[model samples]
Structure formats: C-alpha cells, structure tokens
Target: MQQLALFIRKEFIHVLRDRRTLLILFGMPVMQILIFGFALSNEVKNARLVVVDHGRDLATAALIARLDASRYFEVEQVALSPPALEATFRRGEVKVAVVFPARFYEQWQHGRDVAVQVIADASDPNTATTLTQYVSAIVYDHATEQREAQALPYGLRVETRMLYNPQLEGAPNYVPGVMALVLMLVCVMMTAVSIVREKETGTLEVLLVSPFRPVLVIVAKAVPYLILSLVNVGTILVLSTTVLHVPVQGNVLLLLAESILFITTCLALGIFISVQTSSQQVAMLISLMGMLLPTILFSGFMFPIENMPVPLQVIAHAVPAKWYYIIVKAIMIKGLGIAAVWKETLVLAGMTAGWLFISVKRFNIRLA
Candidate 1:
C-alpha cells in the first residue's frame, strides 16, 4: 500500500512540475464549457440590414419600425435608390435588404394584396435564409396587427426571395464548413504533431544547426504538409460536387487560389504551435482543443456568430476558420468572385503573415 501511494505521489509531482501541461489540462475544459455554453447558438441576432421604402408612408414606416425593434436585425442604413441598395450588398455592409413598392401602402389600403421584397445576400445560404424567414415573420405579424385594427378579412402578403441560394439547400451551407474543419485538422494538427515528433526525436535541433537557413528549414518541413493539404482540398471539392451534388458556382481556379491561401494560414498556425510546444502530445492536444473546437463552434459551421454573446462574437472574429468559411460559402454558394470576398481574403492573409512572423520570432528566441 505504501509503494502504491508513493508511486501515485511521484506521478502527481511529475504532472504538476510541467506547468504548461497542467495549465492545458485545467484550461481546456473551462474553455470548452464557456464556448459551448455561450458561443454555440443557432438563433440569429443583430444581422446587418438595409431598407428602401418607396412607399414612405405610415404602413411602410410601421413595418420598418418592427424590423428595427427586432433582436434579429440592425437597420444600418436607408438606401435612397436601388443602386445604393446594391452598393450596400456589394460592399458586404448588409446581409439583407427590404424593399417596399412605391404604392405599397396605397395597394394595402385599397384591399389589394401587397408584396414586400426581402432580398438576402445568400453568400451564407443558411444565414440568408434564416434572416429572410425572420423578417418575413415580422412582416406577417405586422400585417396581421394592421388587419385586426381595420377589421379586414385579408392581411398583407410578404414574399421572400433569396438571392444566391433560392433553393436553400443544406449542402451549400455545410460543404464549406466541412472543408474548413477538415483542412484545419489535417494541416494544423497533423503538421504540429509531425514537427513536435521531430523535436522529440532530437532531429529538429540537428536540422536547426544545419547549413540551411532556419526559415528554409521550416519552409521545407511545411512544404510537404502544404502540398498534402492542397490535395485534400481538391478531394473535398471533387466529393462536394460529384457525390454531394453541391455545385461550384464560382470560378474553380479562384476557389483553388483561395484554398491555397487558407492552407498556408493553417500551416503557419501549425508552425506556431510547433514552436510553442516540444512534446507531440501537447501539440496534438492544443491542436484539437484549441483549433478544432473553435473551428467547429465559433466559425459559423455549427452555430451562427451573431447569435453568440458580444464578447464571444469578438473572439469568433479571431478564428481563422470563420473567415475561410465565409470565403468558401461566398465562392461556392453565392458564386461571388474575389471582388466580393476581398476583405475576408485580406483578413486571412494578415492572419497567416502574423502567425508566420510570430513563429519565426519565437523559433529564433528559442535557439538563442
């Protein structure tokens, strides 16, 4: 009994001595709980929206007021002309646009059915479809209230039109999500573990001391993984289109270009992880807990970002998968070209550069 107790005590001491391991063990669960509890939600809120009210009458004003009051929408601007509304959507400023016909109020008052056009930026088909539904429900409710007040038999008719994804297919929503998740796991987690394994075998130090520049050594190590990740991207694209029947509506070359960019980002993140940790186990754990969980929960794959608490939403913005997911959906589902998704691309490029810079700096400091 004494021997067993001594063995247990020794193991505990060893565990506690490694503060990084201890911190990871304790911090991972808390992070998962906080993220899953707060950040993971399907409900949409504060969706940026634009309104164009040609009616400009009491009825139109009341409907717009209802939308503004709802938690689901934030009325950002009132577009003066159709071109202005187009500009807003083109700039990615708003996800939804509400357009009321010029004689909307007059038609409603004359006992005729009125139609309010709800145009959604279906780049993210799921968000676009959900926002359209929410707005339509609000419009229907307002029409019902007006009908009751007037003691009318018929109420307003609200028609919703999804711009990019008229069918609202689930594949379009999930394909990009799956791509982001898979690529992150393979590129980041696998590369991190591979690099850490080299360190554990004592070969990484030998390579560092080799005649080749440290940056070249790191790039050489990353090149194989980068190529593998790109092959995986091709496989995903093939499966998404052939087996899943999800069409690549945009330019295929452009999608490949973006995929390469995202793969670079993940590889840099993996290098950063490798630089931080010496143990393969630690690298794997961080990759899974830190990268995988956030990719799934905070990247709009399983939950909408707008539904998360404000602080969590801010954190979601930092997740690389979030931007890549948006880019994929915009390209694959919306058929939007690089022009429409330039901001997301830029953000991802910046993240990649930042991760690489930090990794290089840390690697140099460790060597010094």
Candidate 2:
C-alpha cells in the first residue's frame, strides 16, 4: 500500500510539473470543440449565389425573393447569360447559379412543372449539395404555398431523417471523437514516450537490474498512467454531458468498459512503440505523426468512411482509432448497450493482445 501510494504520488508530481504538457492535455480539447462547433459544420448559411432569371416574371421574382429571404442563399450576382454565370462560378464568386427557364411562370400555370436549373460547382461537393438543397427547398416551399391556396396538395414531400442525431447538435458527434483522441494522446503517446524516456536516461537498465520482476516493473510504470487516463475520461464525460448537453442514453457501465478497453489497447500500443524506439523524441515523433494523424483521419471523425474512396476506406479498417471511434459513437450517441458494441469490444481486445504480444517478443529479444 505504501509503495503504491508512493508510485501514485510520483506520477502525479511528474504530470503536474510538466505545465506545458498539462495545458495541452487539458486545453487543446476545449479549443478543438470550439473550432468544430463554430468553424466547421455541415449546416451552411449565407452562401453567395448567382441568379440568372430568364423568365424575369412575377413567379421568378417571387422565387428569387424566397431564396434571398431564407438564410441559406445570399444573392451575390444577377448574371444575364449562361457564359457569365459560368464565369462567376469559375472565379469562385458564387457557389450556385439559379437559372429560371424562359416563360417559366406561363408554363407552370399551363400545367407544366416549373423547370429551374441550378448549376453548381461539383468540384466542391459539400457546398454543391447544400446549395442545391437550399434552392430546391425555396422553390418547393413557394410551389407548395401556391398549390395550397388553390386547395391542391404539393407534388413534393421531402421527408428528411437525421439518423444519429435528429437535432444534429455538434457535441454528440465531436465529444466521442475528442474522447478517442484524448485517450490516444494521453494514454498511448504518454506511455510510450515515458517508457522511452526511462530507456534513454538508463533508468530502465537500473529497474531491470533490480530484484523486481520485469512484469511487476512494467505494471508499476503503467498503473500511474491508467489512473490519469481514467481521470481524463471522467473530465471529458462530465464536460460533454453536463455543459454540452449531450445525453448518454447507453449504460454508463458499458461505456466505461469500452473506454477502459480502448485505453488498455492504446497503452499497450505505447508500450510496443517504446520498446521499438530508443529515445523519447523518436517515440513522440512516432506517436504524433504516425499514430495521431491516422487516428484523426481514419477514425471517421472528419470524413465518413462510407463516402471515402475504396482504397482509403480499406486502409481505415486497420486503424484501431476507427474501431474506438465507432464504439464511442455507438455507446455515447446511439445509446447502444454492450450487445450492440460487442464486436467493437472484440476488435479492441484483439489489438491490445497483438500489441502486448509484440511488446513481449521485443522485451524477450532485448533480454536475449
């Protein structure tokens, strides 16, 4: 008990003394949350658009008014011809070009669907999609209102269903990704670098030469990190659920279990990396560039794998961060129980086992 307390105290002191690292560990996440919530989001507004209204009649005027009135489209240009509209898009002056066919109102009133062509830069797919939706929504709303006034049902019914988050609150998705990143950084990177630091400083040799068993030494080194990682998990959970108002509908126990499993896997990975590298700097480099980038890119945090190119999507499957992100999303956002996340749990277990086995093999090779 005394030894354990001493070890805990030493670890806490080490953590606290590194003020820069401590600040990054605690502060970066808040910064990332703010950035993701405000700067980067699927919900777009005030997009600059060009209107090429060939009809120039009451109906086209009304549609233009609707488009401008709604917050989505900002009428930036009123180009007269297709060539001018194309030039506006080429110069990136507008995201969308709204073209109303000649005699559009006359055709609609004479039993024809009003054909409004929305030309968008497909190179920027997200912007194109949003702009198209904005235009379609305005046109649909106007058409529906006109039909309803004459006691007729609108021809279109847009049934939009948001799968995971109905309200699309930013935190539900970001919080889980943040937690996974934190675990990867604090748990795995810290463990690997800390172990490598000991090796570089020759303390590892001292420990091995001591009477303490190798496994016990490893456990002692990892125990402090385990506690720190758990504290971080608690801190994030509290902030996300309480301040961000993201609900945890799943069993808290199940979430914690998955979190623990993820932490263990990361810690084991760190140990494996530490065994591979000879210096703290090398470990840190590997952790950041090699591990961190893949964790963020491949983890479905920024881009949906379903939409990614086939080869990139295939590569994402091997990244442990991907599985951890899925588990966190399932448990946190979807309120899935253990049964729902068992496959993810198994994958994490497998990764942990693989890393541990590698570490053991390396340790034995070094001993020999």
Q: State the C-alpha lDDT per candidate.
A: 0.79, 0.78
lDDT of 2: 0.78
lDDT of 2 by residue, 275-330 (tens): 88887889988887878788788899877888989999999988888898988888
lDDT of 1: 0.79
Clashing pairs in 2: none
| Clash number for candidate 2 | 0
Q: Candidate 1, residues 277-335: lDDT per residue as tens digits? A: 98999999998889888998999978889998999999999999999999999899888
Query: What is the number of residue pairs that collide in model 1?
Result: 0
State residue 53's C-alpha deviation in candidate 1, in Å. Answer: 43
